[model samples]
Target: MALFTNIARIQDGLLLCSDSDEEADYTKYQNYAKQLFQKLEAMEQKIDKFSIEESEFTYHYYIANGVCYLGFFKKNYPYRAVFAYLKELEEEFRRIYNQQEIEEANRSFTFIKFESVIRNLRQKYTDDSSLADKNIQQLSENLTDVQRIITKNIKEVLERGEKLETLNLASSKLSNESKVYAIKARNFKWRMWWKTYSPLIIIAAIVFLVLFIKFFIW
Candidate 1:
């Protein structure tokens, strides 16, 4: 059985809708998904599909057209099935909402009404054993490419301590002036090294040329 599923905007990690996983104490997994949102937001190029493996569960997420569909499922659950579910959810979401609606929304879970659809789809894929088997087969025969998608350990990913765009966004803030200054300082150091040593290098080259001409040519 699935634990949780949600849809969010990749641009800013806004919660558009989340499935209701009743009676499941999946707050920890939900937090992982939220962290991924923040991590994915500043990425210039996002992963189209990926999974994070945890102890008891694995998180599957897919991105398309600036939207992200994420799900947390049992560790034994088929990755192909999970990705297929996400793709279907993404398609249905696109059918109901356009890019403008997704972008212009100000509040979290603005499309709470869409939660029903999410729950229905999750049930359709998870509850029925036969359907899940068939879907996994279809995914294997098609271009799901779940095998090639990147999968990272959740603990290692969290321990990496946000070495992301803008150089460790978590160490300070989003627009961390420190990193910017660090880059500038590096560039300046290289320029100063050249400025100071360039004269010595030129003099050495001239002396070598003169010595060579005096000895060999003259």
Candidate 2:
């Protein structure tokens, strides 16, 4: 069963719109969603789509055109189905909200009108009808091996948010070290070549000098 769906701008981690399910108390999950958005923001667009498992719920998300479409579902729900749901939402969102509107928005829920579209699509996939199930199976197969998608526990994700800056600094240090190693390797190669060929080069020069004296000076 679908629990909730939220769409946000990936660049600034600002909510754009979502399904307004009034019956469920999703406050806890909403907090986690906020932290997850921060994690995504720090990731610098490394991963666009993924899932996180916490308690008995799983969040499946997809990022396209700088917007992230994410949803929540029961742990037993076919994660593939959630991904299919996100894909449909992405298309509907792009059709309704142009690039300029998506980029220019300065506040959350700028296009709250998309909530109705989200509610309808969520129902379409989560329904128990045979056709809906079959459609989920077929459409989601294209997103093959979603089970292999990066799934992390809530603790790891939240804690890693603090460590992302350190990781980035370490990455920059490693890159600089790599460049130094490359320069050293090139110098070592040139030195070995000089050591191997210097004797032959010196002999060639001596022979040319001797020939000049024998033919011309003598």
Candidate 3:
């Protein structure tokens, strides 16, 4: 039989169990119980969605390029998986945002991803009615808005770039045409000048020839 088999009593909210032996083995059992409790708490947290009041959300912005847009982040948010996804987007569009011009865009994408994942997780938690599910509904909605804005802006920028290219090509063609027309006009002027001088020289030569012939006959 254990040395302290029945001596252990309930202290606070923990089971104070002791071993019925010369050296008590409470340490082992206590450690095991603590581990189990931790696991249970973690499980519970997963099932319940944490509420985030809208009033706490002061960082939300809409971004658009032309056709569609996405959200931007203001502060770093906790959520590893979601933040990783957002980091990818930021890296992809870093050049478009003029990295140095607005540091906010980078931050915004991160927050949006974090919020989106949390919202999905919350929905899942709600379905099961778990206390661990921390549903960030407000953040999720904001992320959606940001995505819309970013998509629109990106599309617009692409369209605008295409248009600029088209206009550049057309202008180049016009410039070439003008040069060709100028060359043709110069050639026509040269021909007209030669024609105008040749007649006068011919008339002078004819008059000189008649005078020379009359002088010889006399």
Candidate 4:
């Protein structure tokens, strides 16, 4: 079980950089995380802090100085510890990298070197023993109340992006099925036309033949 699933830097409603836990299944969680990130971006103007709850995990995020820091943790994990870890990450990131460098980056995971820091911090926080440590307890006490932070469920977080993907997929499937149905309908119509008109044409041909025999052959 990975404690921290992802870390990202977002600015001006765009994801500037990101890193993910390699040991975990990236495919399974990336969409969920991405959806949450988008939600954070949408809500950034209204609120600077919040948590998004999913079935198996929770996304905690903090935005400051035009940079957003996000983290993913299991639902049972301590909320204070999660935020504390993120705060530490933000401070370290600011200390090491300047704002201009982050803003100018044009690609995902532009600060790929930061993954090493993320891994080290994840190990320290994931350990059960750290929860009982006096320093951690003090840190939790000093942290802000978890209730004060805005909370949104997974459906609400995914309401836009994930829903759009699902809708697009359904639409594509319907389009293909509609094409098939159209072909079937056209074939059915052709069959009906042949059934209704073929016998009349045969009778007409026979009548023409009889007329020719009487008028010319006789």
Q: Estimate candidate 2's alpha-carbon lDDT, on a 0 to 1 scale.
A: 0.67
Residue-level lDDT of model 2, residues 1-218, one tens digit each, is: 46888898887889988774689899889878876776666554655556677888887667777888878887766544555466668888999889999999999889988888888886665443233455445433443422243344776768755433322122223223324433433455566679889999999999999999999999
C-alpha RMSD between model 4 and the true structure: 25.2
* TM-score of every candidate relative to the true structure: 0.64, 0.65, 0.19, 0.59
lDDT of 3 by residue, 115-198 (tens): 334334333323322221232332333332121111222223334442211111112232233243334334545666678898
The 10 consecutive residues of candidate 2 with the worst lDDT sum are 166-175
TM-score, model 1 to reference: 0.64
RMSD from true fold, candidate 1? 20.9
Provide the lDDT at 172 for model 2. 28
What lDDT score goes with residue 22 in model 4?
60
User: Regarding TM-score, does 2 or 4 come out ahead?
Assistant: 2
Cα lDDT computed for each candidate against the true fold: 0.67, 0.67, 0.28, 0.57
Question: Against the true structure, candidate 4 has what lDDT?
Answer: 0.57
Query: How do the residues 6-81 of candidate 1 rate in per-residue lDDT, one tens digit apiece?
Result: 8888888888888757886788778878877877765635346656678867776677888878888887665545
The whole-model C-alpha lDDT of candidate 1 against the native structure comes to 0.67
Which segments of model 1 are wrong by more than 4 Å? 44-46, 127-152, 162-218
lDDT of 4 by residue, 108-208 (tens): 66787887877776675554324345544453454333334233456653554432221111122322332443343345456667888999999999999
Relative to the true structure, candidate 3 reaches a TM of: 0.19
